[model samples]
Structures are given as structure tokens and as C-alpha cells.
Target: MRYERVYVIWDLYDGVRTGVADLDGTPHYFASQYDEGPDDYSDNFKLYPVGTEFMRRAARNWNIYRAWERKFHNGETDLKTHPGHGGIDAEYDELRSWLDKQVVLLEALPSLYRAKFRELPNQEGLPGGMLRELEVTWSPSPV
Candidate 1:
């Protein structure tokens, strides 16, 4: 049997918002496992729960920011600012908090588990130097 594990890395802005989600809520840039059946996979297949949570939070924030940006730019809001009428500082703070939480979660992962969180190499001009990739590898337990 072969097992499959998925890893997802997200680009966050200043700590609060998610720039993107890998694919339709799936976070794996690269995923592979040896066993095909669930029986062959480890019991802890979904070990990175926090990472998933982080992505969800980031996605939500990103959507909110995008909406705000649109409204502000389109003159739909009474605020006056380059991105919005006001609350720019507040948004930045929110984004920063989100990013900080993400870091905490990443750092909390066990060293053994870090390999499973692999971050894909950045091809875009975007900065991703602060993010760490976790690589996941699976092997059968020794007899």
C-alpha cells in the first residue's frame, strides 16, 4: 500500500493576511506517500492541524482585505486613503497579528514533523524568505 501526505505553504503579508491559497483550499505544493491504502499510512495522517487552521484564517483575512481594497478604490466607501478611507493602520495590525500567529504555529511543530511542511521555492518576485518549508516523508516502521 502507498500513503499520501500533503504539505502547504502560504505567503503572508506582514503576518495577518494570506496572499494565496495553493489550490481550492488544498495547501500541498508537493505531496507524495508510499502506501496507497489508509491502512498503510500512519495513524497521524492529519498531524498538522494548526497549519491548516492558519491557512483558513489567512484566506479569510485576504478576502476581507481584497473587498476593502475594492470598495475603497471604487469610491464606494466614505473613507479617504490610498487603499481606503481610513482604518489602514487597523488592517495592518490585523494582518500582523495573523502573521505572528502563523509563525507561532509553525515554530510549535515538532522538529521531526517540520519536514512535512515543505515550502516550495519562490518563483515569483514576492518575498518569502521568512517562511520555512516542511517536508513530509513516510516509511514503514521497522519489524
Candidate 2:
């Protein structure tokens, strides 16, 4: 018989804030691990704070919107054929609006952590790449 298991790993780092990624490379919530156990994964696995979280949420929200847009454009899912709902167009718009606010929130995370690690170097050895692979079982992009 064969079996599969799952586990979660956590990492703690100093001077790293907990939050989402921003357009400007800012380290937020540096400490944390992927949701899964030792394996191979590739993704940004870090618990973000409210502001950064909002941004991350927005990005995800937009992704959903984009998917819907593709589906609708490709005639895969339409209101006429699949009535009862107005399709995902409205949802896409709403998500886009929320994403704007999220961007604003994400922009603030860097400033919040600036004073904390101002003197320190920007790049601190964080286990993002390795942890993603170990926990998610996916290959990460070359750093």
C-alpha cells in the first residue's frame, strides 16, 4: 500500500514584515513557510499583513477576472446560453476597482518597515525559493 501526507513549515525572520508583494521590491512578512510540507513547489509563500494582504487579494481577484474575461470572450461561458447570472463582466469590473485600493495599501507596507531595517542591507537571505519547492513540489524560477 502507498500513502500520501501533508505538512506545514514555518520560518521566523527578524526585520521582515508580514504582508504582500509590491511593485517596488519591499520585504514584507519575511518569515513564514508554504502551506504544504517538504516536497517541491514554486510560489510566493508568506503571510502578509492587512495592507499587503489587500494587494495580494487584489491581484488574485484580478486574475479571476482575467480568467472570466477569457472565458467570456472565447464564448465558453455566456449569459445568454447560461442564463440566471449576468456573467462575470460585472465581477471583473468590481475586482478591478478593489484592486486599485489594494495597490494603495500595498504601497504603504514598505514605508512602514523602512525605519525598522533602514541600516540593514536590502537583500536578506530568506528561504523563499527553497521553501516553495519543498512545500509545494514545484520548481521555482532561477534567482
Candidate 3:
């Protein structure tokens, strides 16, 4: 018997949490990772105060990672240099590195700011944590 590979569609979203638009105007980011499954395995969205550059780059690189992973898993031959400067794998590595650095920065935020991420009362599609913890800092709570 033969088995097929599963390619999960990973996506990112940045926006104000529902019902909290009036409370907090700041936007948050979250990633949703799932395939043709019933439920959406997306994590809580979090704010990323590092600026739009980080978010833009992250989205672009994520697409690269998704495409590359599919190619690698399916044993595709075009796993060579992509539109980016380095090879496909290299581009993926760069994305990982950038992500790691961002995580570290999030972790380093002062406790006062970091606590906001956890204090979010409603988990209504809002960012729960950073990529793992790089969630942005906010002045007011969106409760």
C-alpha cells in the first residue's frame, strides 16, 4: 500500500480582536496551522510591536517555508534556488533565524508588558503568544 503526504496550510492574520475594537485599537497577530481537518489549529493572536517590517517579512518568509516544505516532502526536483538570493533551504533557514531572534526579543520585554499577553481575558481569536512568545507589547488591555 502507498501513503500520501499531508500539507498543512499555515496562515497568519493581524487585526484587532473582535468586540474589542473600541477598547484597544492596536492589532494583534496569530498563526493558523491546519489541513483539511475539522477544527482550526490556530494559536491565540498576540501583538507585535517590533514594527510592520517584522510582520511583513514574516508573512513573506512563511510562504517560502510552506512552498519549500511541500517540495521537500513530495520529493520535487525544483528544490533549487528560488526567487530569493540563496537556495530554498537557505531561505527557510533565514526565516527560522529571524523568528528565533524575534522570540528572544519578546521574552526580554519587561514583565509589565509581557504580562498583558497572558492577562487577555477573552481568547476570541486574539493572539495568545508570540510566534511562541514574541507577541507585541501594548499600553492598554483589550478586555
Candidate 4:
């Protein structure tokens, strides 16, 4: 079977928020930058239960963000909460590190699994230079 693991990366003003969730995905996986059409861009990095309780709590937080995301399914609503809004929420660091671990796992995915994520289309008009905000996609084993 073909499966594509997806992680939504939030390039917020302070830092990045990336997450992975394999709800019902198979062990095979891949990770890559998210590509979306001009008209469709709605998907957050879902988080599965696979880490310390703190990590799980963070995953659940992403879930809550997603629920808020659904209210504006058209992708017009912005779910990002800035640190400046209140002295940079300390959780940013914790979440970032946790998310990085997930990236490490994606890098280890076999070539075939990696290809599934590379199958993204509509990759035009992507500006050059350092990218602060980007969504990463990758699949992982089913638990």
C-alpha cells in the first residue's frame, strides 16, 4: 500500500512548530516540504500518541489547534499564536525540540517511503532564500 506521512510546520514569528501523527498509518514513511495549490492549503501536522506525557500533551495541543483550524476550512483563518502576544510562550522551545525528534525519524525512512512525500505537485512560485515558515510532511508506522 502507498502511504504519505504529513507534518504541518508552523513558521511562526518566534520559531517553528512541526509535528507528526500516524493515527492509522503503516510503518513505512517519508517526510518533505508541504506543497499546496493556490486554492487549497488546509492541513496541520497531526500528532499521534508516541512519546513522553509532555509530548503527548503537546500533540493534543496540536489537535486543539486543528479543531480551531476547522472553523475556517477555507484556509482564511490564521491559527498562529505569537510569543510577543505574551512574552514568547516558553512552550515553544519544548515543542520545537520534540518536533525535531520527529524529523529525525523521517530522515531515516527508506527511499521508497520518501518518494511518496516527494510526489507533491504545484511547486511553482516558491520564493528563494531562507525559509522561516514551511510545512513538513512525512509518514510513519502504525501503532
Candidate 5:
């Protein structure tokens, strides 16, 4: 199935968000939050169409990030003593660098693809709807 959009649900307060759809808007192949998680029904979202190589790379990087996370958590939690610390750390750093680069590119590529976000209703006297175009940001995990 060819995906034409990406569906991302994020926490505005904690930056703990996960992608719910594929590069083209279908659910990710692997079972994840997209399949069954708290955010499955979340109303807050950022939707972006698949348009550029950078966006594609971000999706791929997210896949790698998931794999790394599984490996990192399933085995060794101690980076200082893990046998594959060098390789693991290198991969982690690379992911971090890619994340950092995304931040920089957000300013440069704002016009490449228009992005939209939807917010849930609240009683804080704030209006909610499709607000403004916000650049995409990825947080590997909750802080």
C-alpha cells in the first residue's frame, strides 16, 4: 500500500508523541501505537503530506529509532558497560544529530510542504481547531 500522508499524534505538554500512520497516511507496518495505544484515539494531531526526501528520511530514521530502542531496552541499560556500547552509542548519536538537523531544517524548509495541526477542546477559555502550520519535530521518547 502506498502511503500518501503521515499522521502524528503528540503530547503538547510532555513532547511524548508517536506517529500513527505511514509515510503516505496508512498505519505503520509494524504493530505500535498506531495499532493499539492510548494515542490511537487522540484528537490532537499534526498531519503532513509525503512530499520531500527529508520527510521520507525522517520516517526511516523513526523505524531505526524503534529498533534501537527495543535493543537498548531489551538487553543492556548501562551504556557505559554494554559490550556493544561503541556501536550503540554511535547509532544513538547519529539519531540525535538527525533530530538536531531537523530542527535547523524546519526553518529553511517551512515552505516545502504545508503542515497542519488539530487540537482538542479544552475549558481553559482557549479555542481549538486547525490552527497554524507548525514545523515537524520528533522526540524519540518521553522525557
Candidate 6:
């Protein structure tokens, strides 16, 4: 099996247990791996916090988005039948822009955030037992 850290985005305000998103803003949490897992999947997965950027339109244009979302979920792809489809695509583009901004914001934080995150459970070369003794000094982003 390939061991890799996935770059998953989440809306921070979403309660701790659910990885849901609120389309009106930037993702609040980013996890490198599935919280608990073995390939959890859903057709709606792409519509959840994982692909929140595309979810932006529900706020600005609810009706158009609802129609498009319904058809897409129902597998109706014809442009004529799905008049709202174009708007989804347009919002997706905007989502990409939002993602770009989030990347910039993440980069501005201390580099140790990434390095430290990777060392999770235990830092490099540390014994597994050390995990129990670990203490972290974390600070929220300030900008």
C-alpha cells in the first residue's frame, strides 16, 4: 500500500466530528489523511468539504445552484436540461481562486507547522513511547 499524506481541506467552523463546509468562506481545517480510514467514499464526496470551493455558489445564488446540484447528483448532464450547469462551472472556477488564496495563507504561517505536522504521533527518530511524553506549543495563525 502506498503511504502518503493527502491534502484535504475542511471548513474549520464545522464541528469537530464532521468535515462539513459552509460555502461562504475559506476552509478552516486541512488534514493530511483521512481521520479514520480505509477509503471512505461517496458520490457526494466531491460536493462536501473536500470540494468546498465548488460549493461557493449556494450562498450568492441559491436557486441556480440548487437546480444544478440536483441535476448533477441525479446524473443529468445535458446542458439544455440543466440550465444551472453553467453556473456551477463558473463557481468552480471561483473555487480554484479561493484555494489559491488559502495556499498563500497557509504558506505565510511558520514553516514548522508543516514540518511539525508530519512528525505527528512522534517526531523523527523518536521512540514510539515518546509519543506519550510529547507536548506541543501551538498558536493560531495571526495576520
Best candidate, TM-score-wise?
3
Between candidates 5 and 6, the one scoring higher on TM-score is: 5
Residue 131 of candidate 5: its Cα lDDT?
A: 27
Cα misplacement distance, residue 72 of candidate 6 (Å): 2.1
lDDT at 70 for candidate 2? 53
Query: 1-143, model 3: which lDDT tens digit per residue?
Result: 11111111133334323111111333223222232355653233333333455555566666675455555545663545443435446766686577557644642222111112322334344333322212223342232
Candidate 3 global CA lDDT score: 0.38
Query: What's model 5's TM-score?
Result: 0.33
| Model 5, C-alpha of 27: deviation from truth (Å) | 10
In model 3, where is the ten-residue run with the lowest total lDDT? 15-24
User: How does each model score on lDDT?
Assistant: 0.39, 0.34, 0.38, 0.38, 0.37, 0.33
TM-score of each: 0.33, 0.26, 0.34, 0.33, 0.33, 0.27
Q: Which residue window of length 10 is worst by lDDT in model 2?
A: 1-10
Local error of candidate 1 at residue 72 (angstroms): 1.9
lDDT by residue (1-143, candidate 5, tens digit) is 22133333322334324433343333331112231456452323333333355455555555554444455555634345432344655654565466446544432211222223233335344223222222232222221
Q: Tens digit of lDDT per residue, candidate 1, span 11-130? A: 333221212223223352221222456534322222223456666665565556555555555566634543322356576457558666655454211211112233345534423332
lDDT of 4 at 42: 26
- Across 1-143, the per-residue lDDT of candidate 2 in tens digits comes to 11111121122244222333322333232222333556433233332344455445545654564454455556676645322133535654565566445534532222212211112233334222222211111112232
On lDDT, who's better, 1 or 6? 1
Q: What are the clashing pairs of model 6?
A: 12-28
Predicted candidate 4 versus true structure: per-residue lDDT over 56-109, tens digit per residue: 555554554444445334354443643323333456455656655664554332
Worst 10-residue lDDT window for candidate 5 reads: 107-116
Against the hidden true structure, what lDDT does model 6 obtain? 0.33
| Candidate 4 displacement at residue 27 in angstroms | 6.3
TM accuracy, model 3: 0.34
What local lDDT does model 4 show for residue 126? 31
| After superposition, candidate 5 runs with Cα above 4 Å error | 1-42, 50-52, 76-88, 103-143
* Candidate 6 residue lDDT tens string, 1-143: 11223232222222222222322243333332233355532112221233354334323343444455455555665456443334445654565456456544443213111212222354444333222111121223221
